[model samples]
Target: MSFDGLVTRAVTYELKNKVIGGKIQKISQPSKNDIVLSIYSLGKSYKLMISANNNEGRVSFSNEKFENPQNPPNFCMVLRKYLNQSKIIDIEQYKLDRVIIFHISSIDEMGFDVSNKLIVEIMGKYSNIILTDDNFKIIDSIKRVNNKMSSVREILPGKNYNFIKSDKFNILENFDKDIYYIDKKTPDNANPKELLYSTYLGFSPTIANELCYRAGIDTRVNWGLVSEDEKKALNKNIIKLRSKLLENDYTPTLYKENNKFKEFYSFRLRHLQYEYKKYDFISEAIEEFYKVNKSNDRLRQIKNDLERKINSHIKSTKKKITILDKNLSKENSMELYRKSGDLLAANINKISKGMNSIRVNNFYDENKEIKIIIDPLKNPWENVDNYYKRYKKLKNSISYAKKDYPNQIEYLNYLLQLLDFVERSDSINDLDDIKSELISNKIIKDSSRNKKSNKEKSKPKHYITINNSHIYVGKNSRQNDYITLKLAGKHDYFFHVRNAPGSHVILKTDNFNENDLISASYLAASNSSLSNSLKVDVDYTEKKNVNKAKGSKLGMVYYENFNTITVDLSDKPKDLYKRIQ
Candidate 1:
C-alpha cells in the first residue's frame, strides 16, 4: 500500500532522467519474484528493482543491494546470458499508462549487431515482463500469457507482442466534446471526487479529488442540468491534465490535504526529497514499505504456528491431568484390609478415629479430595496386597506429574512470548531470530520432513568493522561460548551489557587503543535490553578472566574479574555500528 501510483511516477521520472540510456552491466534475478538490473550510467552504477510480486508491479530504481542466490534460478541464467552488457537505447510508455517498454541493444554471440525489447506491463494481475526481438516478436516472457492463461491476450513466444488499448473513456481527447454532457449529468448531491472518478478512466479517487480541488470546480454541481459557466470550469480542469502529461509541462503542486497529519502528503510531479519524519531517508521508506508488507504476510504464518503449539500443548496437558485424576480416584484396595486387620487384632479402639482410615492416592494430590473411596469387592487379604501395589504406582505417577506440571506451565509462557514476538516482528530477520531462539530452547521441534543428515546449524558469528579492525560478536549461546573461549586472545578485552540479555562483544585483540575499546563498550551497551536506557551499564574485563560454567547453557558464561560502569546512551554509537562493511 505504501507504493501507490505517485511512487511509480517519481521512480519513472528518475529513470527517465538518469538511467534510460544507461547500459545494462548485469542482469540478476536474485529471487523468482525479483529482478535486479545493474546499469552503468553517467560513470556510476545504479540498481533498478523490478518486483513482479508487487501489487502495482513497479520497476523502480533502488540503491538497496540484493544478494544473489547461491544457485541462480533458471530464469536468472537465461536473462544473464541474453541481456548482460546490453545498451538501454530508449525507455518509453504507451498512452500515459502504467506500462513501460525498454529497448535494449546488444551483440549476438557472433559479434553481430542485435537488439531486443524488455516490456513491463504493470496492470495489476495482468502484469508481466515480455522480452522480444527488434521486430516485436516475443522471444520469451517471465510469465507466459496464453489463450488458456488469459482470455484477453495470448503472449506466447514467436507471436508479435501488442499493447493493450484503453477501451474506457479517454479523458484528454474527449474532454471538450463531452464536458457539457458530463456537467449536465453531474448529480446535484454527490461527492465531487466520486463524480470525477465515475467519469474518468485510470484515475483513482485520490487523483479525482486532487483534480477537482485544484480546478476550483465543484463536482456536486446540479446534476439534472448545468449552466454554460459550469461546463467551462470542467473543460479547464481537463486541459490542465492534458498539458501536464502530453505537453511535458507538469507543474506539480503538493497540498497538505489533511491539515492534522501534514507529514503524509501526495506529491504531484516533484524531485526526490530525502526528508521523511519517520524514515531516515527516502530509500529507508522504500525498504520499510517492503519490509512491513513482508512482515504482515509472515505474521499470519507465525500466529498459526503459535496457535498449533499452544493448542497441542493444552490438549496434551488435559490428557495427562485426566489420566492422573483417574488413577488417584480409583478405590484403594487396602482400606478394608486395614479395618479387618484392626478388628481381628481386637483393637477396635485403634480402628476408630484416624487409625484405620484410608488415605487418598498420591497421583491426585493436586486435587486431594477427588479420590476418597475404597474398593468394596476384594477380600481384606487381596485388598492388602493390591493396595500396596496401587500405592507404589501412585507414588511414581505423582513424581512424574510434579515434574511435568512445571514444565508445561513454563512451555505455555514461552509460547505466549513467541506469539507476542511474531505479532510484533517488523522484518523477516526478526522472525528468523525468534525461530532460532525457539529451536535453540527446544520449545519447537524441527520439521519431520527435514533431512536428518543435515546438522543443526548454529547462529553464525557476526563481526563489526570498527577502526578498520574486525570486532567479533556472538549471535547465540554456542557462538558466544566460541567467541569468548576460543576466538578471543588473552590480550583481547571482553565487553558485555551489565545484567541484560545481549550479545557478547570481543574486541579481537588484547592490545587496543583507548578510543577503540570505548567504542566497543558503547556498541555492546547499545545492542542490549537496556539499549533505550538513558545511561547503559556495560561490563568489561580481560578475556582470561571469563570462564565457562560446568553444564551451563551456551552464551551463559561466568566471570569473576569484571567491572561495570554506567555511560550516557548516545546516538553516536550508531555511526560506529554503521561502519560494519
Candidate 2:
C-alpha cells in the first residue's frame, strides 16, 4: 500500500538508468500475478520483477528465486511473442501517476521495424501490465478488464488505449507554476494529509504528513488555523522537495519499529521518527519490503491453518476423555454381578424347578435371608451358569476399560503439549517439526509420503552462566527430547516445572555450584506458561534419573532422585543468562 506514485517514479528512474538500452534476454512468469524479465545492458544482466498482486504490487530489481511453472500462462506467452529479444528504447512516467511505460523497438513479421509500449500500473487492486502498439492500441494485458469490471476503461485487445486523465497538477513539471495552483486551490479547513495527496499527483499521505512535520507545524491543526510563519516554512519545504525531485536526488529509506518493517519510500520520512535503515537505491528498499511482507503473510497463513487442525483434534480428545470417564463410573456395577452369582450358587441346593422366586442368603452376610429370582423353565444349574456368565462379561469389560483409560489420558495430554508447542513456535522449521510429529503419530496423513528428510534438526536454546557453565533449554517437544535424551550426560542436571507443561533445561557439567543450578532452574521457569507468576516450582535431578515415560508421547518423562527449587527469576545471577545467537 505504500507503493505510491512517487515510488513508481523512483522505480522508473532506476530502470531508465539500468535498462534503457538493454535487450529483453529472458522472460518468465513465476507466479500467476508476477513476471520477471532478464535484461542485459552494458555487459550486465538484471532481473526485474513486476507484480500485480492486489495487496502487494510493485516493480523492483529482485534477487529472490522463484519456481517457474513448466507451462506458461496465456499472458506470459503473449508477452514473449511480442516483447522477447526487443530492445528497450526509453522509459517514462505518465504525469507523475503510478504508471510506468516502456518503449520497445522490434521487428514485425515482415521484418519492418515497429515501436511498442509496455505499461505497468501500480495502483492497488486496479494494477495491471499492458502492451500496446505505437498508436496506443491495446495489444494484451496481464489482467483483462471489461465493462463488467470497469465501465470507465476496458483493456481488451484492439481497443484504443485511453490513459486515465488526472485533474491534479504535476508538481515536478514546473514548481513555480504549480505552486500558484496549490496556494490558490487548497481550501481553508482542509486536512493537510488529505489535501496534499488530493491536490498533487504524486503526494501520498506519508509524504504529506512528513511535509507538515518538516515545516514544524502541528499536523492536527487544519490549514485555516496554521500561522503565517508556519505557512512560509511549509512553502519553503515544498520548494526544497521539488528541487530534490527535479535533480533526481533521493535518500531511499526503510522505516522500522521494534526491528519490524513499518514503511518504505523513495526519500527519508520525517514524520515516522522511528529507527530507519538506509538503502543506496529505491529498488532494493522495495524488494526487501516486498520479500519481508510476503514471507510474513505466508507464515501467518500456515500458522493459522496448523493451529486450526490441532485445536480440532484437541477438542475431540477432550470429548473422548469425557465419555471414558462416564464409562468408568459404571465399574461399581461389576460388584453387583459377582454378588448375584455367589448368592445363586449358595442357594442352588434349596432351589426347585417350579419356583419363581426364593428368599435365602443368610450365609454370605451374617446368614441373613435374602430373596433371589429364578426361571421356572430352566433348571437351578442353568440359572447358576447364567449368573456366572454375566459376572464374567462385566469383569472382562471393566478390566479392558481400566487398562485403556490411562493410555487415552496420556494421548490427550500429548496433544495438549503439542498445542503448546505450536503456539510458542517462532519459525517455520519449528512448525515443520510439530507437523512431522503429528504425521508420525498417525493424527494426520503425510502429504509428501515419499519425501526424504534431509534437513538438519533444529537446535535448542543455549545459555551460559557467569561462571562459564553451559545450559540448554528446549522450546518444543522434539527439542525437549533432543536436550534431555541426546544432549544430556548421565551426571548432568536437568530441570523442569513441577506438574506443568514446560521446557527441559539441562546443565551439562557434573561438578556444578549453587549459582549454576539457579541459572538452569530460572531458564526452566521463564520458558514455561507460568513465567509471569511470582514464583514457580522447578524440579531438578541428574540426567540418569530421568527416563522416557512408557506408552506416552515424545518429551514425556518421569524422573526420580529430584529436588524442588522455587524459582523467583529475581534470585538468579545478574549476568547469568547469555544466549548464543
Candidate 3:
C-alpha cells in the first residue's frame, strides 16, 4: 500500500541512473501481468521488473528469478519487436506522478533510424504497460481499455497517447502555492496530514505524517485549530522536504517491526515506530520488502489449502465410523433372533394356520412363558425359517464389522496426523510432499499430473546438537517414512509426541547422553501442533522397536519399550543445533 507516487519517483530516479544508456538484450513475460527486461549496461547486467498486477503493481530492479512461459504473450512479442537491441535514450516521470517513460532509439522496418517510448502506469487497478512511437502514438498496451470500460480514456493501438489528468500540482514545482491552497482548503475536522496528502501530488500519507511530526504537530489533530506557530513550523518542514526532492538527497529506508516488513520510503520516515534499515538503492529496498511479504503470503495460502483438505477427510471418516458402529450394535442382537426362531418351532404343534400371535414356554429362559409374533400369511415352519435366515445374516455382518473397526480408527488417526503436519509445515516443499503422499494413498487425486515434474524429493531436516550428535526431523509423511524406515539405523533413537500428531525425530548416534535425549524430545514437541502448550509428553524408543503397521498408511507405526519424558514446550534449548537442511 505504500508504493505511492513518492516511491515511484524514487524508482524512476534509480533506474535512470543505472539503465539510461543500456541496450535491451532480452525480454520475458513470466506471468500474464508481469514482464522482466534484461539490460546490459556499464559492464553489468540488470533485471528490471514491471508488474501490472492489481494487488502488487510495481516497477523495480529485481534480483528475484522468475520462470518464463514456454511461449511469449502478445504484449511481450510486441515489445520485443520494437524495443529489442534499442538503446535507452532517457527516462522521465510525468509531473511527479506514478507514470514512467522510457525513451528508446532504434531502427524501424523502413531501414531508417526511429525512436520509441515505453510507458508504465503504476496506478493500483488501472496499471498498464504501453508502447508508442516517438510522436506518442500508441502501438500496443499490456492491457486494453475500450470506450465501455473507461469513460475518461481508451488505451488502444493506433490511438494517441495521453497522461491521466490530475487537479493537484507538482509538489516540487509549486511548493509554496500548493501549501497555501492546502491550508485554505483544509476542513474544520480534518487531520492536517491527511489533508496534505489528499490534496498534493507525489506526497503519500507516510511522507505527510513525517512532515507533521518534524513540525511538532499532532497528525491526528484538526488542521483548523492549529496555532499560528505550528502553521509556521509546518511550512518550514514542507520547504525542507521540497529542497530534499530538488537536490535528489534521498536515503532509501525500510522499516520493520517484530521482524516483519512494515513499510519502505524514498526518504527517512521519522514518524514510523520501528528500526530503520537503510539501503543503498531504492530498488533494493522495494525488492527486499516485497520478496518476504510475497513469500509469507504464499506459505499461508498453501497451509490453508492443506488444512481444509485434511479436515474434510477427517470429518468424512468419522461419519463413516459412526455408521459402522451403529450397524455393529444391531448385529450384536443376533442371539435374540435365533431364540425367537426356536420358540416358534417348539409351538408349531399348538398354533393354527390363521394365528398371528402365540404364547409359548421360553425354553431358553428357565421355561418362562413368552409372547411370539408370527406372519399370518406364512405357515409356522416358514416363519421359523425366515427368522433363522435373518439371524445368520446378522451374525455374518457382526464378523465383518469387527474385522474393519480397528482399520477405520487407524485411518482416522492418520488423517488427523496429516492435518497437524500441514499446520506445522514451514516451507512450500513440505506441503508438496504431503500432497504427494495423499495422492499416492488415494485420499486425494493428483490434479497436477500433466504439469512438468521439477520438484525434488523433500529431505529430512538435519540438526546438530551441542554435544556433536546428529538429529533428523521429518517435515511430512513422506519424509517421516524415509527417516524412520530407511535412513535410521536399528540402534538409533526415535522420538515422538505421546498420543499426539507430531514430527518423527531420530537421533542418529549410539552414545547420546541424557542431555541429547532431552534435546530431541523438546524438538519433537516443538514440531507438533501443541507447541504452544506449557508441557508436553514425548515418547522415545530405539529404532528397532518401532514397527510399521501392515497395510497401513505412510508414517503409521507401532512402538513399545519406549520411555516417556515430560518436557516444557516453552523452554527452548539454549544451544539448539543448527539445521543443515
Candidate 4:
C-alpha cells in the first residue's frame, strides 16, 4: 500500500537510468499476474519484475528468483513475440500517477521496424499490465476488463489506451497554483493530511503527513484553521519537495518498528517514528521490502496452520487424560471390592440361598457393620468369586492408566514446544523443517505428497562467540536433533532455556570461556518465546550428558550434570559473532 505515485516516479527514474537503451533478452511469466524481464544493459543483467497481484503489486528491479513454469503461458508467448530483443527507448510515468509507460522499438515479424508500448498500472486491486502499439491501441493486457467489469474503461484488444480520469491536480506540474487552490478549497473540518492526498496527485497519505510534519503543522488539524505562519511553511515545504522531484533527488528509505519492517518511502519520512534503513536506490528498497514481507506472510500462514493443528491435538490429549483419571478414580475402589468378597465368604454360614442380601460386620474396618448384597441363586461362594474377578480387572485397569498418564502428559508438553518452535520460525525453510517433523510423527498428514521429493534438510543457524568459539542454534526440532546428536562434539557445551520451549544452542568447542558460555545462553534465550521475560533460566551441560529418550520425539532429550544460568532475556549481546547462513 506504500507503493504510491512518488514510489512509481522514483522507480521510473531508476529504470530510465538503468534500462533505457537496454535490450530485452528474455521474458518469463512465473505467475499468472506477474512478469519478469531479463534485460542486458551496459554489459550487466538486470531483472525487471512487474506484478499485478492485488496484495503485492509493483514494479522493481528484483534480486529474488522465481521458478518459471516448464511450459510458458500464452501471455508470456505473446509478450515474447512482440517484445523479444526490443530496445527500451524511454521510460516515463503518466502525469505523476501510479502508472508507468515503457516505450520499446523492435522489428516485427514482417522484418519491418515497429514501435510498441508497455503500460503498468500500480493501482491496488485494479492494477494491470497492458501492451500497446505505437498508435496507443491495446495489443493485450494481463487482465482484460470488459463492459461487464467496468463501463468507464474497457481494456481489451483493439481498444485505445488512455489514462484513467481523475479530478486531482498534478502536484509536479502546477505546484504553487495547486497549493493556493488547495488552501482555499479545503473545508474548515477537513484534515490537512487527507486534503493533501485527496486534492493532489503523487502524494500518498504518508508523504502528505511528512509534508505537514516538516512544515511544523499538526496533520490532524483542519486545513482551513492553519495559521498564516504554518501556511507559509506548508507552501515552502511543498515547493522544496517539488524541486526534489524535478531534480530526481530520491532518498529511498525502509522503516522498521521494533525490528519489524513496516514501510518504504521514496523520500525521508520525518513524521513516522521508526528506525530507518536507507538504500542508495529506490528499486533496491522496494525489492527488499516486498521480499521480506512476502516471506514473513508465507511463514505466518504456515505457522498458523501448524499451531492450530497442535492445539487441537493438545486438547484431544487432555481429554484422554481426563477420562483416564476418572477411570482410575473408580479403579481405586478395588480394595473395597476385595473386602466385600472376603466378608461374603466369612458370612456364608449365616446366609441362605433364598436370601437376597445380608448384614455383616466389616472386619477390615474395625468390625463396622455394613450391607453385603448376594446373588441368592448363585450362593455365597459364587458371589465371592465374581467379586474377586471384578476387583482383579479394576486393579489391572488402574495399573495401566497410571503408567500411560505420564507418557501422554509428556507428549502434550512436546507438542507445546513444537508450537513454540513454529511461532519462532524465521524463514520458509524453518517452517518446512517443522512440517517434516509433524508428518514424520503422524501429527499431521503430508500435504506435499505430490512433490517429487522432500526438500533438503535446513541447516541450523550458526554463530561464533566473542571468544571465537562456534555456536549453532536450531531453528526447529529437526535442526535441534541435528545440532545435539550429530553436529555436536561430546565435550561441547549445549544450552537451552530451562523448562521452556526454546532453541537448542550448541557451543562447539571444549575450550570455551565464560563469555562464550554467557553468549550462547543469550542466543538461546533470544530465540525462545519467552524472550520478553525479564529473566530466563538457561541450562547448560556437556553434549555427552544429553540423551534422547527411547521412542521419544525428535529433539526431546533429557540431560544430567547440567548447570543453571539465569540470564536477562533483554541483554542481547552486540558483535558476538557474525551469523553463518
Order the numbered candidates by lDDT, best leading. 4, 3, 2, 1
Per-residue alpha-carbon lDDT of candidate 3 for residues 1-581, written as tens digits (9 for 90 to 100): 57877788788888889999999999999999898999999999999999988878889999898999888999999999999999999999998898999999998888899999999998889999999999999999999999999999999999999898888767778455645566776677988888778777877788888888888889777887887788888888888877887778889999988657889888888888899899999988888888987877787898898788888889988997887788699864798889999898877788677778889989899999988888888887988988899899888877877888788899998998899888877778788888888888888778884655678867888998877889999888777888999999999999999998888999998587987988899999998877889999999999999999778888888899999999997778777577777
lDDT at residue 133 of model 4 (Cα atoms): 97
| RMSD score of candidate 3 (Å) | 2.2
TM-score of 3: 0.94
Which runs in model 3 stand beyond 4 Å of their true positions?
178-181, 256-260, 274-276, 351-357, 375-382, 449-452
lDDT of 2 at 426: 72
The global C-alpha lDDT for each of the candidates, from Candidate 1 onward, is: 0.61, 0.83, 0.87, 0.87
Clashes of 4: 0
User: Candidate 1 regions off by >4 Å?
Assistant: 2-10, 54-56, 70-74, 169-181, 184-201, 212-242, 246-288, 295-380, 403-431, 446-581
Runs with alpha carbons beyond 4 Å of true place in candidate 4: 174-176, 338-358, 363-368, 373-393, 449-456, 466-470, 487-494, 507-517, 520-529, 570-581
Give the runs in model 2 whose Cα sits over 4 Å from its true position.
107-112, 176-189, 216-222, 340-397, 448-457, 463-469, 531-534, 569-577
Best by TM-score: 3
Per-candidate TM-score against the hidden true structure? 0.61, 0.87, 0.94, 0.89
TM-score of 2: 0.87
TM-score ranking of the models: 3, 4, 2, 1
Across 252-282, the per-residue lDDT of candidate 2 in tens digits comes to: 9998775467899998887897888899999
Candidate that beats the other on TM-score, 1 or 2, i.e. the better one = 2
| 1 against 4, candidate with superior TM-score | 4
